[model samples]
Structures are given as C-alpha cells and as structure tokens.
Target: MADEGRRDRCLAAHEAPPVPPEGPVTTRLPRRSFARSATEVAPELLGHILARRLPDGVVLRARIVETEAYDQNDPASHAYRGRTPRVRVMFGPPGHLYVYFTYGMHHCMNVVTGPVGTASAVLLRAAQPLEGMERMSIRRRTDRVRDLCRGPARLAQAFDVDRSLDGADLVRGSEIWIERGPGASAASIRRGPRVGIRVGTDLPWRFWIDGPWVSVSRPAAVLSPR
Candidate 1:
C-alpha cells in the first residue's frame, strides 16, 4: 500500500525535504456550483481542484479527496450554538471560504454551502497535490506527495490557507478559489462517521473516494453497505 511505503520512507528519511511541483495555473471551479445543501455538496466535491495563487504567480493546486458535511442543526457543527464572531461566515451565502484556526496551531477550511442564513458547510479534508508542491513542502516540511495534504490542517498549510481567507469569495476569482477538476461518480464515493469528534460522530456525514489516498482510515461500516 502507498501508506506502508510511506511509513518505510519516513522511517528512513523522515527529515528529508520534499520536492515541489512545477506547473501552470489550472482553472477554478465556478462560483454558482456551490449552491447546494452541505450534504449534497460533500461527496460531490471529491476530485475537484482547490487552488491558491500567490502574488508572485505561483499557483498551488490540490485535488479534493475527502470532506465532511456540517449542517446548521448538527450538534457537531460550529454553528450548532448559533452564529458568533468565528462562525459568522458559515451563515452567509454559499461559495465563500469559511476558514478557522483550530488547536491554536493550524487552520482548517470549509466551503460555505446551503441557502443564505443557513449555517452549513463542507469541511475540506484531504487533497492530492497537483501544482506548486515545492512551496507546499516548505510550508509542510515534508517531501512525501501523499503527506502534503493528507489531512485538513495539513491541507491548509500545503495551500497557504488560514483565517485571513475567512469569508473569501470562492466564486469571485480571487487568490483562493475552487475550480472544476476530475470528479468521481456517486458510486465511487463512500461515507462514514466524522472524525475527531464525539457528538454527532455517528451521523455518517464524512465522505471520500473509495480507493484514493485518504487522511483517515476507512471506518468499519461503509454507509449503505454496498
């Protein structure tokens, strides 16, 4: 497995720096595309590109591989307590970035979804690195392509995402925006309990491609049990 190989490499060269990617900027996903419920948006996000372009013209790109849905009424969501200073953007319209700092150490990003006044979003989990990986390596301090964005916090670091991007318009062609890229069919997507939480963990809102590399291991029960 790729992960096993990664373990071996890490044991051998855990301190080695990663090689960055070199490429042109890829297109961004349209703004209108995010006008859907968080549940409808999560699984569909797989294989799409989430990109960040620097002022120097270096474009960092990653293919979204995993996500988790957070609804207004979900007990596990930040907005479950109603809107506040930190979660205000999540209550806004769709297609905007809802970034937040977590653990006092790293940032995580989510795409605001659902109708206006609805506090729902899809947490971007893992992504497959595509462009400008050299810089990503510098930010993440690792050379493993799979390790670049194998988790949400790591994804933020790999793409230079942080609280400053909070409420940024994703559909507005800005420094950070999502662009249409490869996507999987519904059957190719899987769902399981959300990670790192006790409340609402059994909701099965987490979604990911079945075979692609992922940050988390597959849960024991696959939703719908194909």
Candidate 2:
C-alpha cells in the first residue's frame, strides 16, 4: 500500500509536520463522538497504519496488528457497564476518542470502531515496530526489536500516546493516523481470539500477519479455537 513504504523505509519519508520546537496548536477533527464497536472495527482496521508522535519529536508508526471487537452486546466490554466520565467519549459520534487508564499506571488506546450508538471498537493489540526505531528503543528502554510495540500498553508508551491523545482524530491529524500498509498475503493473515479478555477470548477476533516479529505475542498459528 502507499503507506507501507513510507513506514518501512523511514519515518521522515512521510509528509507530516515535525514536532515543533514549542509544540504547535493541536488542530484536527475532534474524535470525541465516535462510539466503540468491535465487530465492525476489527476487519476494517486490517491494512491501516497506526502512528503516534514520540517524545523526541519523530513520529513512531506501526501497522495494526491483532484487534478485538467490543460492543454493547459483548458482555466483556466496558461500555456495557454503562456511561461514566471515562467512557463518555464512547457515547459520542462515530469518530471520537476512548482513552482509559489500566494496569496500575499504563495507558492504552483504542479507536472507536463502529458507527455511533453501536459502541463497538477495535483494540489495537499489537503493532509491527516501524518508524522511530531508535526513539522507541529509548522510550521502551530496549534494543530488542520484538519487545518494542509488542503490547497495547508498551506501544502506547513507545509512541508517547497517553490521555493527551484521547479524542484526537485519525482522518486528519498529526497525533495519530493510519495509512495503507503492506498487504498480508492471503496465506499470511492469521486470525484468532482477542487478547487478555476472558469473555471475548472465545471469539475469533484476533488478527496478525503470520510470523511477523511485531505481533505482541508469538501465538502459534491458530486454525481454530483452543
């Protein structure tokens, strides 16, 4: 795809504003109204690129890895628990932000996956470490390629994504955006259960490029359920 080369080659190869010396005014579509819907959001994100601006001012990018769909009917989702200040954004339109704090102090990000009111979203489980490799190494404090951006929480930190990015838009924003990345050869695309959710694990919602070191975990090729 048009973005794969941009990502695979170099972060600067893509035409995005460099992080300003004093931080430019954040301008873009307000992703405050998009609801989270997993079913619709997962498959749609397959070829999209997920990018974040790092601390050093370089943009760190990754291709979407495994994703899980969450919706109202999906008992495992947080929305089903009802609206609170934290999830209020999930109740907004179809292009809003849904940010939350979990695992003690780490922050994780999710794209409101489906249309408004659907409350479905795709959980960005893992990403193939792309641009900003050195900076990523610094933030993650590791030189091991597989350890960086291998999990939802780690990727968020590596990309410098936090509550600050909540409600940021992807269609036209510098903070986070997806570009068309490499096509997983039909045979290379692997699918399975979404990670870490005891309830949703039964559903075949996870997806990843077979054997790409960037997959958050080295899950064996799953042909069917566990």
* Candidate that scores best on lDDT: 1
Q: Please provide, for model 1 over 115-186, each residue's C-alpha lDDT reduced to its tens digit, 9 standing for 90 to 100.
A: 889999999999988888999999899988889999999999888776666777776544677778878777
lDDT of each: 0.79, 0.62
Error of 2 at 204 (Å): 1.5
What is the total number of backbone clashes in candidate 1?
9
Residue 12, candidate 2: Cα error in Å is 25
lDDT of 2 by residue, 88-113 (tens): 66665665446667877888777775
Best by TM-score: 1
171 Cα displacement, candidate 1 (Å): 0.6
Query: What TM-score, over all chains together, does every model reach?
Result: 0.84, 0.74
Clashing pairs in 1: 18-143, 20-133, 20-134, 21-133, 21-134, 28-179, 29-178, 29-179, 29-180
- Could you tell me the lDDT of residue 32 within candidate 1? 56
